[model samples]
Target: MERPSSNGDCYLSLHNFKQGGLVYRDYLFTKDSLMVFNSFGDGPISQSTGAREYYFFPRKNVIPQFSWNSSDRRLEVTATDGNVVFFDYETTAMTAASNLLAK
Candidate 1:
């Protein structure tokens, strides 16, 4: 959907699907292009990308480094200011236990 900004500028509104509730990602239109927060990340990661080393760490480790190893075919991830993590391209863990399963 489209909406007008309070400053008289126009912006494009976006919606995101989340587990508990919906998320919104609004895009501001500029003269050249539309600018939006990269909530997801800079871009997609792969063996050639995430699987490799990254020198550009976030200011406060808020943005962790992720990579894929073509040799091992595994994904390597680093937590914010913590130990490194790896996944064998298997199922992802749930954020929290479902209420239906809880007392």
Candidate 2:
């Protein structure tokens, strides 16, 4: 996951591999919160389904204070519920170049 600057938007992509298939979800960060946009998989997933569900029942409020450790390739996000979620990511050349341009 690439860290977003304050007031910047970030895309979060989650992938679950099981039963020889892949389940994926795409979310966007806006106003310090996450909103689900697209998803595909099987079974009853617990995540928010679509725009309506996300608008009505959003995910946890994420604080704007994002921490990114380039060396470790980790990102830390704090939520309003006093919980923290950490993500480890791999950066490609395109992503790294894009991040530089963003800065």
Candidate 3:
């Protein structure tokens, strides 16, 4: 998700993966670096839901270099750990009603 903010535009990405169980990673992309928060099961399972309690890890800053394509349709991100990720993206047009509401 992308949204306008007072400082600048903010981007958020959430990813889920399976280790022994389900784990969630939340990333907040900022101007200088990307902040990451991780959450996973830790405690004992619940009697009703049969799910373990969730433990959220502290946020960490991961520096990444961002490059946008000339057409603005593709984005290339290089992380400090020498990992590269490419994303294909597009913009959404706001409806007239939404634009008015935003104003």
Q: What is the TM-score of each predicted model, taking all chains together? A: 0.29, 0.34, 0.32
Cα lDDT tens digits, model 3, 5-52, are: 576655434233332453444455443444555455555434212322
* Alpha carbon lDDT of each predicted model: 0.36, 0.40, 0.41
lDDT of 3 at 27: 50
Residue 10 miss distance in model 3 (angstroms)? 2.7
Ordered list by lDDT, greatest first: 3, 2, 1
| Among all candidates shown, the one with the greatest lDDT | 3
RMSD of 2: 11.8
lDDT of 3 at 15: 36
What tens-digit string does per-residue lDDT give for candidate 2 at 1-103?
4455566654343332321343344444343444544444555555524442122123445433356768867665443333444555542111221111111
In angstroms, how far off is 91's CA in candidate 1? 4.6
Flag regions of model 3 displaced more than 4 Å.
6-8, 16-22, 44-103
What is candidate 1's lDDT per residue for 1-103, written digit by digit as tens?
3455687654333333331322223323222232333233344433112211222222234434456667865555443433344445333211221111111
Task: Put the candidates in TM-score order, highest first.
Answer: 2, 3, 1
Question: After superposing candidate 2, which stretches have Cα over 4 Å from the reference?
Answer: 1-23, 28-38, 41-62, 91-103
- lDDT score for residue 25 of model 3: 43
lDDT, candidate 3, at 72: 53
